[model samples]
Target: MLLAILLPFLSFMVRGKILTGIVCLILQITLIGWLPAAIWAVLSLNNARAERRNDKLIRAMKENGR
Candidate 1:
């Protein structure tokens, strides 16, 4: 679910205490948090595509002496 995908990010984002980190990790295991997972997937995929496009453009520019 959403929490499952976001728990690690939250842990990194908050620099939280161990207890809160554990709670966030556990929250991901529940069925009620799927929307976050979907959002996370979309964002990650878009980032990947953007990186690929940038790389391709840079390579093309190099080849063309641009």
Candidate 2:
């Protein structure tokens, strides 16, 4: 979260979205676009977390024959 807020473009790169990271870097290059880029990074992080959690749950359910 800190990375997302402090360096929005870097966050995207860390997540392995090179194209998106580049776009974010471009957006973050301007002061006016910084806030939106940060918000986008944070939201993307949250969604990634949720997807991971859902994947874990699905795996557990499959193991239990559910």
Candidate 3:
């Protein structure tokens, strides 16, 4: 959804019509042909953030105890 709106901007950044066309095609394929992988990427990022937060909290607790 967001990618559709940003497509023109991305195309402008790349500055090559052929490359832009190929990139847009890949993005479209990602949105349709490979949605699960995108979903997993988001999920994995969220999990990594959660793990980092937990590690920070645990370290803080240990430091306070000392």
Q: lDDT of all predictions, in order shown?
A: 0.54, 0.98, 0.52
- TM-score, candidate 2, is 0.97
In model 1, what lDDT does residue 34 have?
Answer: 42
Q: Encode model 2's per-residue lDDT on 1-66: one tens digit a residue.
A: 999999999999999999999999999999999999999999999999999999999999999995
Model 3 lDDT, full chain set:
0.52
Extract clashing residue pairs from model 1: 2-33, 2-37, 4-28
The estimated TM-scores of all candidates read 0.53, 0.97, 0.51
Candidate 3 is scored at a TM of 0.51
lDDT digits (tens) for residues 3-41 of candidate 1: 325454363234434564455445545667445544554
User: Which is the better candidate, 2 or 3, if ranked by TM-score?
Assistant: 2
> 1 or 3, which is superior by TM-score?
1
**Leading candidate by TM-score:** 2
The candidate scoring highest on lDDT is: 2
- Which segments of candidate 3 are over 4 A away from where they belong? 1-33
